[model samples]
Target: MRTTMKLDGADLLDLARGAAFLGTGGGGDPYVGRLMVQQCLDDGLTVEVIDPLDVPDDALVIPTAMMGAPTVLVEKIPSGEEAIASLRALEAHFGRRAFATMPIEIGGINSTIPLVVGARLGLPIVDADGMGRAFPELQMETFGVYGISGSPLCVTNEYGDSALIHGRDNKMMEWLARGAAIRMGGCAYIAEYGMSGADMKRTSIRNTLTLAMRIGRCLREAKDRHENPFDALLRLLPDTPYSYGRIIFKGKIVDMRRETRAGFSVGRARIEGLEGWDGLMEIEIQNENLIARLDGQVRAIVPDLICIMDSETAEPITTEQLRFGQRVTVLSVAVPAIMRSPEALDVFGPKGFGLTEPFTPIESIV
Candidate 1:
């Protein structure tokens, strides 16, 4: 059965927190998503979350997501109408009405994007997502494992211009779509991976929205109880183990050296670890962190979730926000088994990020 609820400002905050926990350190800013969703909610849009079984077997289900660098996405905000335009274009391309719209990932800016589009289209939003955790590429989805392609993608810019692209494969789809996003000034709304509800249920992580809500609730509850929020998260997701690490350092942000070449946020953060640690730790970023080195020793790297969160509240910090001397706790979570397969490595391993050496499972390192 389908369900509907209206989210106020407080509800949106809870949703953002929950989505961030599910993001697993790769989705873009949840703050921007929060603002967009809040705007829709203020306009009195009712968010309808529908179960996967509620959709018919033959129903057309299209998953939508933001394409391009997260830093650029925040700067070049959606033209408000582009989200709806992307959906409308897909509807036009398929020559049929879409039964539902949904998120490709269940967190960050994506968690609320589908809702905005759904509110505008008067359509129901699916309660699931292709990837239970956030991934870096369009093709790195469970849908891909089930042989779904992201081609026939429709990208719409803020100026009402739309382009329908056909890639020989999902890689081509990402390439062509990324190029177009650069031309569109670094961000464009895209609707891709059209499939049936049956196919979606088989490929997607079921009840991911519910999972996000649960994660958010746990974080809030942990804070109230003065318990470890990270521990609470681990308890919530027993399938994924959380890496044990300390509040290695904390300091004010002094400088930010960044570049947006190759469509990735490539930068080095220089933070002077405070208290017992009295030196600099060099942090790296490429969409997400690939390495963290302290005083010339490699501390953490890929396949591990090495993320920087606020020292007090434990909120995640994206690559773009890694500034010098920032008061932050560098935390690492053991990678989930889902991302450890050779095939999965071939798609998103250290080599995929241009690292020649093979990835060492995070558990082996810390």
Candidate 2:
């Protein structure tokens, strides 16, 4: 079993970049998180990533990330210590310090923000995350699906404002925290879904931190070797739980509608096919890409990844960054077997988002 890994130089950046890809058009941009981690390194900080199995069963592990509209995040950048403050608030409420910090979801900034917390606090970042991909709401995560409570969640914004929220359920927690975020200038950092190491082993997606890094490494190295980056991605994913990676569509954004509403960025995008591809593909969003349809037939849906990237550079575009006339390729990957369970689907699948479409795997639908 893997014990630990040290992130420095390109490792941190690759992890951030790959997270941007896995984010599936949510989790906000990794660019800011990458810069923060790089700054930590510049200040002679070390980011130690520990395997979840190494965590003691009794230890408290808190997953930390920024929560709110990704569109709002672009304008309201974090002050870097907001998450740490959130964690401290949790610690104060629990009357015990945290054993480690981890990402609640695998997305651009959320994927790397915990590393920033870890380096600043001198704690290890667990190589695990609550969700394999980003989701719109806090309740839509494996942590909640598998019975981890999302409160006593601590929400904090820059300028030292903070609130510790408790809820009867994860959905209630999301509602309360999201309202807090919107009131706090539209974005806030959070530390929530606190659980024991045992809870992590049972519910969290393991090794995703390293997987995100490896994904970035593959794309970067492939480019250096003058190979197709997308081909490198397809080759790399099958070996992991998120498998069956394929190009679902090639197109240019013909039209897009996006807005920051109710503390979430909600919208849809239409991509007209190019490169011998025909028809149009539509991707609906609520912070993250939820369902993608090609010519009105579902090719991918929630719980599976529906990623849009720069066709030439393979750079993942968040919902906020999406625009008209950009050449993009849609890559769909199957989620881990755990995320597809009927119980898990109830919280994060199509029905979870109020859609009538039955949950279907990318391989089956495509």
Candidate 3:
């Protein structure tokens, strides 16, 4: 089915909140993304979302995304043309006529990026994404798990520079993409991993886009009803357990350290906890929080959701968007069962982040 909607500022804010929730504490900041999409809406652009099933079985679907450091993506706003350039480059490289475009990940800015690309390219946005929750590496996609190749991937810098990256494997594609992104000043526009709807059915996480919308809807309703939004979200995903933790840290951000290294938002935060707990807590982030330490001793890490939410309102905060002096809550929710598999560990475990010991799921730790 094809549907068109007029997404205004309120819609964008709600969608951003919902996208953050579905992001599972990983998709980059939704703030900039909401602003960009709102700009498109202001330009009288109507974003159309199409069900993947609406496309022909053999329909060629290309996923478009922003690659590099999320921190840079905010300062260096996309020129819009680069998103199209990446899409066009992929079309030319494949030597096949293009089909539809889809969001690669469901995060803040990326949630609506494909809509910008689709509006510009005159393509429809696929009502789904590859990963229901964001991961650090491009190869961590369920699309890759189902045997899809990352390249020949198309990338474009805001300066009109464009290139095609080919590699022996997905890992190589991820490495080269990150390197290129760093060279492009910590962020690059990417249109990659073209595949069919049938393949998507096999490889992609189903209904993630719809889920994002629902997640967004839930938050909006929760807020309007003056109910506990976070609790409502926990109830929505019955399959995922809540790993509870105190508001160990709540204070002004004293310091923030971030770098776009190895194609990830690697950073650390120093926050002083208030109320009962006092002192500083250190958070280590790479796309997502992998470790939380209190005065140099480990507190919470992977396998549990080491979530940072707006302390006042309980909205989720992505690693890249974190700033100093922002009051936030650090909650450790249990990891979903799907992420506990040995394969999942290899992709996002403690060892994956170069921690010395193997991962002990956050559920076990908490």
Candidate 4:
């Protein structure tokens, strides 16, 4: 089915919450994205979401995102032109106008940056993305997994400087882009994985924007009705690509360490279990929560989503936002089918992140 949806102010607010949740402790903060979208809405611009099926097979589609440490994004806010600049640079290199823009990942700011660019350029945004959840590097995208080359990648910083990287594969592109971001100030806007609409329809994670909105709306409504937000989330899980999820732990952060290094927010958090529970739960993170261990036993690992939320409000806490003594609840959701395949696993599995344990599906673990 082909459908076109419009996001208004209220919808964007819900989307911000859901996108942040889906970020799984990465993708940068959705708060900044929400502000950007709100400003666009206030300026009378419209954001249109198009189903991938609606795009012409021959049409050019570009995925745009912010690359580098999420913490850096908080201080060095984008000038809004960076994303557009990257897209324009890519167009110049490819010699074709982009038919539309889409998110590289439907998590946090990356999810909304494309919408901002699409509105500015008066183009539709395909309701799909490269990664259903956020990943640390460019090569971790499903597009890369499916053999899409990330050549002619474009990167731009807030100061209006832009660079185009070519003659390299996706993995090399990540390294080059990361170094550029570090040199430019630790964060930059990137546009890569350009492809034909047909290729995107085949490789992209479909309808994730709608999924994030649905999740945000569910949590909001649950709070308004004084219902348990956790139960609301669980009830809605079956309808999304991630059909299984559970609160793996509830505790207060007792120890945490984080630093922005090599364009990534790398850190670990230790939580003291509460409510009659004993021992501690530790989470390893690199931009996103990669793994969780309960008293040294693997409970959840990357390729699956390990999410942390405020214990009271159910709002997601990004890796950079984790603070000592803050009560939190950890949740794990099964990743989309496309991301769980053996091919996809090689790019984001436990071993890929230097963990010794073999990747186990969250469903199998819990």
Candidate 4: residue 157 lDDT (0-100): 90
TM-score of each: 0.86, 0.98, 0.85, 0.98
Candidate 3, residues 1-366, lDDT tens digits: the string is: 555444556667777886775564566668777777777778877776777767777988999888877766768888577878998888888788667888877766778788788776778787777665666778877677657898989889989887799979988998888788888888888998899878876666555566666667776788789997766766776532332333345665789888777667787888887757677898888777777777776667664456677867877888777888898777655544555667766766687678775665544553
lDDT of 1 at 312: 68
Sliding window of 10 residues with minimal summed lDDT for model 4 = 162-171
What are the C-alpha RMSDs, in order, of all predicted structures?
3.2, 1.0, 3.3, 1.0
Error of 4 at 206 (Å): 0.4
How many angstroms is residue 289 displaced in model 4 relative to the true structure, after the best TM-score fit?
0.3
- Local distance difference test, each candidate: 0.72, 0.91, 0.73, 0.90
lDDT of 2 by residue, 171-206 (tens): 999999999999999999999988999999899899
Off by over 4 Å in 4: none
TM-score, cand. 1 vs. native? 0.86
- Which ten-residue region of model 1 has the weakest summed lDDT? 239-248
Error of 3 at 30 (Å): 1.8
Worst 10 residues of 3 by lDDT: 239-248
lDDT of 3: 0.73
